[model samples]
Target: MTIRVVVADDQALVRTGFRMIIDARDDLEVVGEAADGEQAIRLVRRTSPDVVLMDVRMPVVDGIEATRRIVADGAAARVLVLTTWDIDEHVLGALRAGASGFLLKDIRPTELVDAIRGTARGELPLAPSVTRRMLDRLLRTAPRMSAPDGLESLSQRETEVLTLVGQALSNAEIARELALSEATVKNHVSAVLRKLGLRDRVQAVVAAYDCGLVRPRRP
Candidate 1:
């Protein structure tokens, strides 16, 4: 299936550049483009794209509010925040506003394409750099909420799986660590997310760090 995408950026050049790369892909299509956040929201509502590439800064509305509106309205389209802002506040704001993941604008074309696909597949495409920034923010700030009530329902094994997920390990890596098949690891990951009412692994990671289920590494 072709994943439909909408590119929203204040810069015409940025939007055009992304459209070129995305339209070149066999499995991806640029269904629409927006010059600002309000337009982004309107395009999303009209086109219902599978994914949205959002820039944080814009003249009207701004990406954060646009993302908030999209997710709050229960749109199926996932938002992948692609902005030049690599700061912790922007990353946290986007995630809290229900972005599927965050990536810097400087990401390679191949990585950008993969991230959109991953977001469409209900996976978080958080970059390592973004993750590091997020972790720093998490360590310094209190969680937005105690956690979803479903967190208390997780089994011990499921909790362990969530902890590994917090570390950003793939299912195969978690499987090897626990001496389980990759399939089993995937199951655990799913259960963990379901039990916690998380939208994706990115939220799971934040929750784990939030509730102190996983501690920050001593670097």
Candidate 2:
């Protein structure tokens, strides 16, 4: 199936560039484009694309709010946030708002295409250096200290899956490491989120760290 994408950025050139790059690939196509978050949502609702490449600093509305509404509505479209700064707080907000992942504005065309593909599969993108610092600071600033009631209900296996998510493992990679099928890993991850009352994997990652289910690597 072709991966339909919606490109939403204030700059017409950026959106056009992304559309050309994505549409050039056999697996991807730009179904629609928008200049701001509000328009992006409307386009997403209209097209129901598989993914959205959203800029964090758009006018009228920001990407974080748009992402939050999209996920909250349980739309099928995934969000891939774009930012100019490394470890920008808005990046965290976007993720917490249900973005599947993020990309640097200067990311190579191939990498950008790959990020869209990965996010459609519910996987995180390639921002390990920036992401690591973001996750660490998030772990410290997060207010999940009291622990949600549903979080305590996770089983041992479910807990493990959440920890791996916190460590940034994709479902396929998690399956390989745990000697399980990708479907099974996905199941566990889903159950973990349901039990934790989380919005998506990004929140799952934060929950794992906040609950001390995983530790960050020392820099």
Global lDDT scores for all candidate models: 0.82, 0.81
Stretches > 4 Å off in candidate 2: 127-134, 137-149, 170-186, 197-200
lDDT of 1 by residue, 1-219 (tens): 999999999999999999999999999999999999999999999999999999988878889999999998788898888767555466677777788788788889999998998889877575544664556554555444466678779998998898888877777778999999999988898898787867788777777877677776654
Report the lDDT of model 1 for residue 32: 95
Off by over 4 Å in 1: 126-145
Residue 22, candidate 2: Cα error in Å is 0.5
- Candidate 2: the clashing residue pairs are none
What local lDDT does model 2 show for residue 51? 91
TM-score of 2: 0.85
The lowest-lDDT stretch of 10 consecutive residues in candidate 1 is 136-145
Candidate 2 CA-lDDT value: 0.81
Model 2 per-residue lDDT tens digits across residues 31-149: 99999999999998899999999999989989999988888777989888888875677887787677877788899998898788877876566644455566776555545554446
Query: Whose lDDT is greatest here?
Result: 1
Compute the lDDT of residue 180 as modeled in candidate 1. Answer: 98
In angstroms, give how far residue 128 of model 2 lies from its true place.
6.6
